[model samples]
Target: MSTKNKRGWIFLFALPCVILFCIVYAIPFIMVMATSFCNYTLTQSPTFLGLDNFKTIFADPDFRVSIINTLKWVVIQSTLHVLMGFIMALILRRKPKGWKFARVAYVIPNIIPTAATAVMYSLLLNPTFGVVKMLYEKLGIDTMQVVNLFGNSKYAFWTVTATWVFYSGFNMLIFLGEMGAISPEIYEAAQVDGATAGQADRYITIPMMKNAFGTCVILASVAMVSQFDIIYMTTRGGPGNSTLNLPMYLYKIITLENNYGKANAVGVIQIILGLVLVILIQRLFNQKKEIEEV
Candidate 1:
């Protein structure tokens, strides 16, 4: 085909996707951004409020707490969650006995619905008839016997963290896929150079998986930023906003408070925050990759 004809066909094929994206994502984003600057609710049309919503959000103590909590979860998800997955991938790579079964078992939690996982954790940590209370009694740990993990301010944050942090199966699968693509010759050469298993992994395997790690970290962090279902299903951002994050706070503005203006303002902040994090992570990874290449 002539170049001009080929270009026409390419445009024709891509047009549908472009139109769909504008309808589904672009238009909604623009609407949300515009609505963020207005006072909007279900019963009334949006009134231009100029930055009042943003101002209110900044002055709200709950918003501050939510921002802090969201940032904390982001850090934990990016570092500890990704690390857990990486460690599991490394262990499975050795292909010890029952490795296949272990891999499948680890993935079960990830495959389950998030709401279901939250419910299971809620029951397990109910502080009354929960399995955790039973275990504590069996172990003679009286101090923890009366603790309501999802209710108390001091323990709710960590309790919510526990429900999701160790469920790193999705991140593990990403790392495992990256590991599988590595050439066997590299390890064989390392063996020939008298490198021990640890040395080979440290000097070769870990370094090679840097890109995958970066990708996983970004995914995990963004997921944490918008995490809501589990916290809502379990703690409901209480007892007294203890486990409140951005999405949970946003949910309150929309549902409980019936304020779309403030909700969209929070949404805009979330979008910007996520973008900033992604850019920073990309730059960090790129800089490291360049240094390694050099």
Candidate 2:
């Protein structure tokens, strides 16, 4: 084909993707940005409000609590959650007894829908006729002293955290795939050099899998920032706002308060926070890689 014809064909193939991007992402983002600076709601037309919405949310105690809760989960998810998956990948890579069965079992929770998983946990933790309650009874703990984990403000955040914190099967799978790609010759070399299995993992396996680790951390952290469904199903951000994160807070502003401008402001903050985190993770990984290369 002629150069012009080739260029035309390429554009033709790309047009649909460009159009879809605008329709699905770009346009909505633009709308959200524009609406965030206005006083908007379900009942009233948008009136320009400058930075008032931003100022109000910043001053709100609930918003500050949500920020703290969201960041706490983000840190926990990125570090502990990713570590759990990475450790699982390392163990499973050894292909010990029942490895195949274990791998499948580990992934089963990931395949289950979030809502269903939330419900399952709720039943398991229910104060009445629940396994946890039963366990308390068996331990001879006083029923009157037993606290409702999901209902008590003191325990609700941690209770919500428990539901998804250790479910790192997807991250495990990613790390496993990365570990598999590593050349066996490398391990063989380490063995020849009098390196123990632990040393080999520390010097070779872990270092080589840095990219995968960083990817898993970024994915896990970002997911936690926007986590809503499990918390919503389990606590609805109550007995107080102890379980409220940014997404749940935004949802309440929109649905309960009918405040589009404030909600969009929250949405904008969330998008920026996610973007900033991703960039920071990428930079940190890239810098480490550069240092290692040197």
Candidate 3:
């Protein structure tokens, strides 16, 4: 085909995607922005309030607590998840005996529905008649006051975070795929140069897997920020809102309190936060890439 004709055909082909983007993403985003400014309960006609929702959400103590909790989750959960995933990926990279079976077992958690996992964990962590309680009792640890995982605020948050860390096998799979794609010749050369496995991993594998690491970081961060199903089904932001992440808090406002506008405001804040996080992660990755190239 002629160059001009090819360009015209490409533009025609891209038109559908552009239209779909508008329909799927742009339209709903605009509507959400609009809803954030209105006082609507979804039953009543929305009345323009002009930032009142945002103001209320900012002033609400519960919302503030939710934001703090979400920040904690984003920082702690994402870091732990990525770190554990990286470690698991590294360990699984080598073709050990039964490696395939181990990989399948690791990813089984990710395959299970979050709600089901949460329910299972809830039972396991239950203060009464739970395996955890029974184990602690068997170990001569007091089951009455010490074995309450969900009852205590400090333990509850950590318990929720722990559940996510081990379930990060999906992230491990991503990193493993990326690591596998690296040219085997590079590792061989490093070995020839008297590099140890640890040294090669430190200098070669990690640096080469920057893109995958960046993707994992972004995914984990977003998942932490928007997590609802497991946290809701497990803790329900219990122990007096101590575990109330942003999404669960927003759910309460919209559903329990019938505060749709305020909930939309929270959603807007979440989107803005997510955008900032993604931009920061991308910039960090770009800087690392430049440094590596140099």
Candidate 4:
């Protein structure tokens, strides 16, 4: 086929997907951007406000708290969550006893719906009739004197943090897939050279998984920024907004306060924040070389 004909055929095949993407994603994004600068709500047409929504978001103390809380969750997700998955992958790399079963068990947390998880954790960590207090009491700690984990300001943030940070099953699956692609020859060579298992992993396995780690870091961090269901189910940004994050705060602006423009402004901020994090993570992981080559 002539190059021109091939190009035409390719465009014809791609047109449906292109149109669908524009309709589903691009159009909503454009609407959000347009409405964010105006005062809008369900009952009224958008009125041009020219940055007023953004200004209100910044001026609100609760929004500032949400930003700080969301940033904290992002850092923890990108680092600790990714690390947990990496560690699990390394553990399974050695093919320990029943590693396949262990992998399945680990993924149960991620597979459970966030609403169910919220409920489970709430019941498990309740001040009374909760395993946490029972365990604390058994350990000779006075649970009767302790506050409910999700109710107290001091512990609520950490409690909510715990819910997602350790559920690294998604990361584990990604890391495992990346690790599986590695050549066995490298491990074999290390073994022939009298390298211990730890040395082989440190020098070969970990170094080679850098790209996968970078990808997981971006996925986990962005998930944190957009997280809402679990928090809404558990704390509802209560106990003085201790567990509040960007998405939860955004939802409140629309549902409770009925500020559509402010919600869209928050959405714009989320998109920009996500883009910045993606770029920074890619640079940090040295994925730019791969991108450039592509």
Candidate 5:
């Protein structure tokens, strides 16, 4: 085929993806931004409100609390999630006994349905006859006062965090892939230099895995921003908005109050936060890459 014909074919093939992006993501985003300034509801038509929704969300006490809670989760997720996953990757990278099975087990949480996972955690953490409750009782802790973890103001947020925190299987899998890509010669060089296992892990493995760790950090952080399932299923932002995050808050504003404008405003803020985080993380990692190259 002629060069012109080849170019035409390339454009034809790319058109579908471009059209899909517009139809799905781009158009919806535009609608959300436009509607966020409106006063439309189930019973009324959209009338321009001019930032009223944004003002309302900012003023809302629950929204403020949700911001704090979400920020806390984001920090925890980005750090703890990536750490656990990186540690697991370091272990599995050696291809020790049962490494293949261990890899499969790691991602089991990711494959499970979120709602069901929440339910499972709830049952396990239930105050009465729950495995965790039973263990605490065995450990000689006072379980009677703080029986319902999800219902208690003090324990609700942390409990919800615990439910999802340790399952760094997805992050582990990502790190594992990155670890696999690393050249064996690098580790051999360290071995030749008489570097201990811990020293090698500290200097070589960890440093080389910076890109993967940064990617996990961004992924984990953004995932916390949209975290709704476990909170919704377990606490429903209850115990007085202790565990409320942006997404659940958005859900309540839309579903319970029919405040679509405020919901979309929350959504716009969420999208902005996610975009900013991704850029910041990429820049942070890129800077590290540059330093390493130097």
Candidate 6:
């Protein structure tokens, strides 16, 4: 085939995908944006209300709580997950006995469905019949009388946070893969300079894995913001809304209150926040790189 004809055929093949993306993703996004400006309950014809939804969401205490809870999840869970991943990668890098088995075991949690995992953890954390409470009792730790993890304001937030931490094997796998790609020559050079293992890890491994770290951080941040199913299945944003992350809060507004306009407004806010976070993370990574180069 002639060059022009070949190019035309390639474009024809790609057109379906582009059209599908517009229909599936872009159109829905546009609809949501449009709906955010209207007072619509999905059951009624929408009235163009121009930012009323946004104003109402901004003024709502529940919305503010959701924002705070989401921020907490993003900062705390992402930081701990990344740090733990790095540590696990470092330990597993040595190829110790049973390390392969251990890696497989680690990833098993991620493979399980989020709802299933939440259900399992819910049982484990049950205040009375749960194994966790039993173990605490055996260790002479005081256990709470109430068994409702989803109904306790004091422990609800942290309990949900803890459930996802041990299941952070995907992040660990990412870091481990990045660590494995580092050149052995660099480690040998560091050793020749009499650097300790810890120093080599801090100065060499960590620095060289910056790109992977950036990717992982952004992924974890987005996950924190959009996380819904596990929290929904576990807590339903309860314990007086202590564990109500933004996504769950948005869900409640739509399904329970039938406030479609407010839900769309929340979605718009989430999208904007996610984009801002991505841009901020990219800028920080670039600035650090420039400093190192200089």
TM-score of each: 0.94, 0.95, 0.89, 0.93, 0.92, 0.91
Task: Report the C-alpha lDDT of model 3 over 128-180, residue by residue, as the tens digit.
Answer: 88888788888998777655677688788888877776678888999999998
- lDDT for each residue of candidate 6 in 16-42, tens digit (9 for 90 to 100): 999999999999999999999988886
Model 5 lDDT per residue over 84-196, tens place: 98888888888899999998998898899889999998888787878877887788988775378888998898989998899999899888888888888988999999999
> Is 3 or 4 the stronger prediction by TM-score?
4
Pairing residues by index, what is the TM-score of model 2?
A: 0.95
Write the residue-wise lDDT of candidate 4 on 109-180 in tens digits. 999999899999999988898888888898999877757989999999999889878999989999999999
Candidate 5 segments whose C-alpha is farther than 4 A from its true place: 132-146, 287-294
Give me the candidate number with maximum TM-score.
Answer: 2
Query: In model 1, how large is the Cα lDDT of residue 208?
Result: 93
lDDT of 4 at 260: 95
> Model 2: per-residue lDDT, tens digit, 64-126?
999999999999999999999999999999999999999999888888999998999899888
RMSD (CA, Å), each prediction: 2.5, 2.2, 2.9, 2.0, 2.7, 3.0
Off by over 4 Å in 4: 1-5, 133-146
Q: What is the C-alpha RMSD, rounded to one decimal, of candidate 5?
A: 2.7
Candidate 2, residue 200: lDDT: 94
Model 5: ten consecutive residues of lowest lDDT? 284-293
Across 6-115, the per-residue lDDT of candidate 1 in tens digits comes to 99999999999999999999999999999999999999899999999999999999999999999999999999999999999999999999999999999899999999
What is the alpha-carbon lDDT for the whole of candidate 1?
Answer: 0.93
Worst 10 residues of 1 by lDDT: 284-293
Looking at model 4, residue 142 earns an lDDT score of 82
